[model samples]
Target: MKLTNKITIIALAAIAAGSFLALAQTPANNNIVDEIVWVVGDEAVFRSDIEEELQQLRAEGSALPPNPYCVIPEQLAVQKLYLHQAKMDTIEAPEGQLNNQVERRLDYMEAGLGSREKVEQYFHKSYAALRNQLREVMRTQYIIGQVQENLTKDVKATPSLVKKYFAAMPEDSIPYVPLQVETQIIMVYPQVPQSEIDAIKDRLRDISERVNNGESEFATQAIMYSEDGSAMQGGELGYHGRADWVPEFSNVAFQLSDPKKVSRIVETEYGYHIIQLIDKRGEQVNVRHILLRPHVSSADLEKARLNLDSLRNEIVKGKFTFDEAARYASHDKDTRNNRGVMMNQKTGSSRFEMQDLPPEVATVVEKMQPGDISQAFVMKDPKRNQDVVAVVRLTSRTPGHRANLAEDYNQIKEMYLAARKQEVIDEWVEQKIKNTYTRIEESWGNCDFRYKGWKK
Candidate 1:
């Protein structure tokens, strides 16, 4: 979800520069002309590029990988290889997604840096100019990433291969596995009574009418009445596409061509909203909205709890398995189809460290053992920010220890697959270097590189 799209933007904080605008000058002295550090095919890796990347890494608190001047340039050179291939293949990044990503990135940077003016000052460019540069960078990044995915998406490791990979690893080099637990849950959102929903909808309809009649500015109304986090910014969701928003909301939002017209009530998992389109450019649309979630009455919440309690009792009495109940009854879209197993978003693993678990889940699970089903309890849903009743079962638990094939086969399989993928990429690079025109300045060729064929 682009709700935390800052993580993606923060990743680019180490991508070196704002774009070519910031890359036009070297660090420490803007007067010095940039020189080519290396040339891969038709693309030139400039000295300023290396310096900018190094500066960005330092700014992001990343440790330099021994002789950053050489390493950073090499990294840029490799990126150019993919970029070149992408161009040849005519890989086009969707403009709307690219613009939306750039907009979100800039929004995040502005908030983190304090203000839009500070962001402009930091980048040494106007907001529009900076956005243009970021859009191009994002486009290139998307193409490069797509190229890499194309190359490695089909690669897979077998159980035997994983076992062999694990056996070959030195005991001293084996990674320490943190204590992790896999959890499964059955969720039931507390039902908002129809009366409450109708009341909120009525209120929203009135607000929309008022805005339509010029009784209030859309942003002013948003700030005054919207419940979303963006209410502080007048419910301005910068610019985004269908991918970043709920389908129902996005459908109604994109259908509005006139900026002044407010959309009727739109219902989504989060709540009810009436959106006013600020502007639309290509696939990107900017909008301000007022969101009003129907309050779940105590009776409704108790109803949800009782429902879950009945389901829990049925599972305990062996009427049906927890997995079956979760699939048939759980309201969580993310885990329902997966047999109730919850995935840790950061690690992309079913297992989660205690600290990484949702606070409510963590607090309850701490007192339970493996195979223990927790009692139905009310907790705020992290995504929707609404009260939900749920019952969780600790599926599996592993103590902190050195990683081994028996208990951690999937992790070993991933490591093996990654190592193999790297080898494949290195081989591809070695061959591509030979076929493509390549030259490195002698001064830049002194450091040890992962691929030595570039020197050829």
Candidate 2:
């Protein structure tokens, strides 16, 4: 389960302030003892809870906040408030979706800590016991998420409010806006010769036959031959959405209903893949595939370059608009629909930060002015792990500067809305605490809490 966007900042800050040495280190001869750290309403926060969270945050290299012991218990108490509200409201994530999330979390932990066995050992619990504990944690996290969303559902900012907020900030304190650019591209994927395509299909067919005949297991074959990163994990890509996959791969993968059946060779931008369905949970699925990419010949590469050049010429000469050309001629599925304007996945903005830009895209963008079209060039597709030809157009550019209301209205507006939302949550918390039966152990009340109402 994930925290809602609104509360994650507060949650992280509160979480980082504490240390749980016992959770971080296990002594060989000593028994681990957990005690009640705080009590909120009918719920109780345990020392173990703080330690587990602290251990995970520390492992992620997050900076610790001041007075963690006091800070973390307060956060836990606040979390319990939301969870209690969630119960009163009868809120819950779907059982299937919750189980999927649980398995995925376990998979990530296992992969990171080396293996499932190692994870169990580190936690000092059997797999079943650990799963049960994680289920409760995930359930509470989701409930808290629902509460956060409900609290801030009406929060918004107007242009006037945004301007006022920006005006109120000291000039020196205004955030620095980084250099950003909006780029458009028409990509040309080299066509694999029929012979090369046929060769790949033949090889996949052989592997399929081997798996069907019990001569080899699908995961075993994947380990020996799959080119993708999932090969190391026996080709198990944990539960993911249909949108996460290319059309060709997802179409064939979602069609396989039987665990024992191997799918036909499916061709996507990545390459030829033979899929094995591990399981399905609602709309999401867990599947494994072995990817085999065919070699693109020099002639094929030149052909693609020439084809893209023709499209670029049409766009540059004003015979066709760049967006028109991109819609009809660009082979990139991700960008073609939106007129080739590349979206920054990190920021969800049309403008890309320099460091976040792909090396090939950055090189062309550096030399081009806004509205300048680039010549056909070879660049690597990071996702497909293949080289292809493309032509780019730099649509817009912004120089680094201190943010102002005129140019950074959205950014300032977001800040204003966040501050307003925080105030609303704080007021709500004060009322909740006054009404709820809360008793914090006196020993836990010594730290400087951002929310003083917690002491009441």
Candidate 3:
């Protein structure tokens, strides 16, 4: 049987902290007791731990199993086994990856909750404390993942094995494929007037001049004027490889030989930037930059829409095929050369589920039929951080259907391989529980568990 879904570390930590605070505030005569529920090897699971997990589940609106008391401890125990194995095998989570994950998770939480203060208030912990707890939890998760990968590294589902796995499956167990669509798009960015372009450049030049003349610090100017997210951090983009930055930015950033000198204004897709060298390590550079983007007026947007509309009219009148127009006229570098076919980044495929398409594209495509071309519509270009006009063609649509060997061979093969890996893990867990020292509180032992040998 499958184990419980992974619990969110933030939610668990919050619940645990609230529980402890509640206990601390209770009268001395209170009867509430928290005690050890189970011991797996050298690790102990507490009653409070189980309650925290339960509270987290409730908070997240997840339905509990028949007896979560029995289920949760087993899940925790299984995780401990993987972590213990990871320790014994000397497996380590890369520090860089760990830090990046922690920061990203914290950023997501802060964004959702409105601010760092709100997150800390809800969790009843300081920002640093929450970060520390998350880091430890993320590290444990990473190590456990490494251990599992090591165990199933050699397990492969060949074509014959995949066919056998599919053949033996019950009819009701077959997976259903969702309706998917393939679309082609031609995107044209609104042209910023030359006056606006010159204005942005002039401002950057003034800022650069001030910094060079010692009238102001680069970091100060960046914090006050830069439009990029790094502005809050004084525009410091930490040490990164040359490949980390766009070609134009990197070319100028690497050429800065003097720390005090600011580079000439550099133009990139995001905007215009002026860079100051901070430091350099073997093949890596650290620089600070201020970015300014030219504003696109309503007139510019209307012009772009009309241009795209004219192009659409040409395609409809048989002046040229949609593919030809996309290849020669589209401004989006990513899809222009590929004949404007939009790829699903999540699946690395040409097909997209309705929800997976961009909001503007989805809105237009939902009302369209195969071979229908949409009118020019405006959408945000996330890469360049600007508004652009686009027209799309519904290339094809596949209706939802049951998975079959003919049309969904790759999907079936992946499912079979994943099942095989989980089977290997389950077998390993069964053996590990037998070999490890485990003790369960008698009061908590009166329920069913999917794995054997845990009662002792």
Model 3, range 305-332, lDDT digits (tens) per residue?
9989999999999999999999999999
Q: 248, model 2: CA deviation in Å?
A: 4.2
Q: Is 1 or 3 the stronger prediction by TM-score?
A: 1
Order candidates by lDDT, high to low.
Answer: 3, 1, 2
| C-alpha local distance difference test of each model | 0.79, 0.77, 0.81
Count of clashing residue pairs in every prediction = 0, 4, 0
TM-scores, one per candidate: 0.85, 0.86, 0.79
Top TM-score: which candidate number?
2
Residues 405-435, model 2: lDDT tens digits? 7777777777898889889888888788888
Per-residue alpha-carbon lDDT of model 1 for 1-456, expressed as tens digits? 011111123224333243322332323445547777688876677666666556555655668787887777778777778877887889999987877788777766655565668777776769897777677667877887788778888788988888888889999989998889999999899877788888998899888888889988888888788889777667778888777888999899889888888998899999999999888887778988889987887888999899899889999999999999999999999999999999999889899999998899999998889999999999888899988999999998899999988898888888998999888788877777778887899999887887767877
Give me the displacement of residue 70 in model 1, in angstroms: 2.3
Could you give the C-alpha RMSD of every candidate to the true structure, in order shown?
5.4, 4.8, 5.7
lDDT of 1: 0.79
Regions of candidate 2 where Cα sits further than 4 Å from its true position: 1-34, 51-61, 109-133, 240-251, 280-285
Give the best candidate by lDDT: 3
